[model samples]
Target: MKTLGRVLTAMITPFHADGSVDFDGAVALANHLLDNGSDGIVVCGTTGESPTIANEDKLTLFRRIVDVCGDKGSIIANTGSNDTLRSVEFTKQAAATGVDAVMAVVPYYNKPNQKGLYAHFKAIAEATTLPIIVYNVPGRTGGKIIPATIEQLHRDFPNIAAVKEASGDVNVASEIYRRIPTDFMIYSGDDGLTLPILAVGGCGIISVAAHVVGKDLNEMIQAFERGEVTKAREIHARLLPIFDAMFVTTNPIPVKYAVRRLGLPAGPFHLPMCEPSEEEAAVIDAALKMIK
Candidate 1:
């Protein structure tokens, strides 16, 4: 089991022209994230278009990323699905594939109550030995994983290793942290909120912005770790424009587009996530330039 310490890059899935999984491209990106100094890679997460990727494709990509990362770092497979049983199955599938951890988001669209939430994750926690990072992104999942409930979960379960605090509620996470044991880690679910989350004692970020600006993201955490809050804040503010652009659209839309623009073999975005309008692409272009 990898001790996830700093920034973990929530990877952007690269597609081919035919919309098939770009296995080679995915491996290349994983290698880039590591070489650029990402602490780990969160494969098949929201940024990776998990909704569209099939089970077989996910297994292939997971193995490919693991093969590419090669013990240099860790891999957090996102197994968050609306179906608890299916999520458990996927988590086990990923664990069997040898991922360091599995990140499962709260039930989406079908918004479950705390009791249902506990049941959902409680089942998955029972199913896999891979460390579970409970993902609570109500902005996307349509329900919150309340702080009090999370504390109860941490208390009851030993493998519930981390919480990806993307609920945009720093207090909620801080309260959970104050309650839970120190071994349980908290990763900022929002790329833009890394420093704030870290300031409030978050360990790292499962970052979308890291898709483009990998090393700089790591530096933000390192600076803060070294007691250079001013430098960390400086880097965070400078990178704010990049972070802003990442969420400008519905995530990977802008991220992949920017990658394609950078001359990577990034392919067209799949449906339900169609190409951004010319205006939006222009904004992304400007944002990429700003980072340059």
Candidate 2:
């Protein structure tokens, strides 16, 4: 069960003045993230304004991202939606495009039991040949993908390759690490948790903080891998404040603000996901500056 290594940027969706998807800006961000140190790119994640994107638009976006990434990074298509059938459809489309993987979160708003969570992912797994990564970010998705379910899923489907553990409960993540197949991967869905997760045997992260702060993320992982635990922890500690501020507002909003600060073409956002307040942008800018 192959999965991503090190960190992958959960890119923010950029938009033009008319609210159209800014394809050019997105390509630039993807390029920047890869050049800076992102091992992969998780396109259309919750942090990427996923809900506001339409099915047709998502198809094109996935295709475009795959083309843009080439082999520079893994193109992890966030195929999850509120409905099982819709999520499956998107997953199959994502597989058709040959993306590296599909990240499916538990159904949101209308929460489901463990059986339902298992079945939702089962349906998605059956739909696509691409490896399925269960994304557990209860803060946004309402429900968590428990480790027990992941253990069962991996047992049943060899293609159910990994979990993105963002629930922020290390104990839960540790329990997951204890049971899953050795080959199956666990990614720190939270940037702040990457080193800790790695210390506990996690692979790495699918990080929003990495959208603007990727070099340090890569360095921390590299240091740890090279047995430089002290240096890795120091970088991790310094990165915590920026990581906290990145989520100070909801996801892509703050990331988009940081991208604009980098003098990128980041502008306007999709509905329900607008730009941060001037004060908020300033705070994000200050954090980005400290790292830069």
Candidate 3:
């Protein structure tokens, strides 16, 4: 089993002034993250406004990012949807785009049971040769892919390679890590718990905060790996406020704003997603001041 390295930024989808997906802006953003510290880029995850983007657009986005950074950094494509059939199709298409791996989120809104979750991912896993990262963000999906089910999938499919544990329960993540093989990777899907997850034997993170603070996040991971617990904890502590702020609103809003605030190519939010509220904006502004 291969690892997608430790500090991947679940990057935001940059837009043009008119709100169209900005391919140039995306190439620039991918390059910028690589230049800063990101080892990989999750191109169309929640932080990239995946729910709002069209299938054709996502394919274009995936192809473009792969074209730009597939060699430089691992390029992961978020191809999961609530519909298994659609996710299967998307995963195959995404694999064709040359991404290093595809992240299949636990089916949202439909709330599948463990058996159903197993089958849903099982079908997708069977459909493609690309390595899969099972995303379990129950807060958003209203369903959890429990540790046992993950173990089952891991046993059943070699391509079902990793889990993005965003359930916010460190114990649950720890249990999953203990059950899986050392090569079967587990990454914290939440930014706030990156160090906590690492302490519990997690491999790394699929991070939203890395968009704004890639270098620090990467340094924190390296510090921990080098047995510098105090240094890693300190970096984690210093980054907490910004991590807290990036999520001040629902994801991508505050983060997209943060990227824009730094004079990056992040353009504007799509509808159903919008700009941060004034209070939230103030919170974000206050938080960003800590970075430099």
Candidate 4:
């Protein structure tokens, strides 16, 4: 299985002022991320405001990012949704776009039981030959996929390659590490828990903060892996404020603003996902200054 490197950014979608998908801007941003520190980009994820992006635009964005950055880094498209059939069909389409892999977030709102979750993912896993990253973010999904279910999926499907464990509980990550095979990767879905999860054998992070502090984040990960514990801890401590600020007002809001502040391509947000308030933008500004 090809690992989607150590620091994958759950990238923000760049939009035109008219609220149209900025295809050219997205290409620029993907290259910018690759040029910086991201090993890959997870387009159309939560930070990318997947909920608001149209399906056609999403496919286009996936293809565009892959076209520009596929050779430079991994491009993992966010193709999952709360609907199983829809997710399966979309995953198949996303796979056709040449992404390195596809991530299926745990079904949100319509909380599914373990059996249902298993079946839902099974259908998606069966639909594609590409690697699948099972995204388990309970805070947004309204339910969590237990380690047992993940283990079962890993065992049953070779393509069900990894889990983005963002439940915010280190014990959950530890349990997942204990159950899954060594080859089955686990990624920190929460930026705050990256080091703790790594201590428990996680492979890397699917991060939001990497948009601003990609180089520093990558340095921290490399420091830990190189036995520079103190150095890693120092970097993590310095980045904690930025991590908190990213969530100061729901993800992407602070991150999008931070990116634009850097004079990057991040444009205005789509409906229901507007820009940060004055107070929130101040917090994000302070946090961005922390990046060294």
Estimate the TM-score for candidate 1: 0.96
Each candidate structure's TM-score, on Cα atoms with residue i matched to residue i, is 0.96, 0.96, 0.98, 0.98
Kindly provide the TM-score of model 4 when superposed on the true structure, using C-alpha atoms: 0.98
Q: Which regions of candidate 2 fall more than 4 Å away from where they truly are?
A: none
lDDT preference between candidates 1 and 2, better one: 1
Task: Using lDDT, give the best candidate's number.
Answer: 4
Clashing pairs in 3: none
Which residue pairs clash within candidate 2?
A: none
lDDT of 3 at 166: 95
Cα lDDT of model 2 by residue, 149-268, tens digit: 889988888788988898998887789889973888889988888888888878888998887778889999989989999999999999988998798888788888888777876687
Per-residue lDDT tens digits for candidate 3, residues 209-244, read: 988889999999999999999999999999999989
* Clash count, one per candidate: 0, 0, 0, 0
lDDT of every predicted structure (CA atoms): 0.85, 0.84, 0.91, 0.91
Q: Which stretches of candidate 3 lie over 4 Å from their true place?
A: none
What are the runs in model 1 whose C-alpha is more than 4 Å off?
none
lDDT tens string, model 1, 49-142? 8899899999999988887685878888998799999998888888988889899999999989999999999999999877889999889878
lDDT of residue 196 for candidate 4: 92
> Candidate 2: TM-score?
0.96
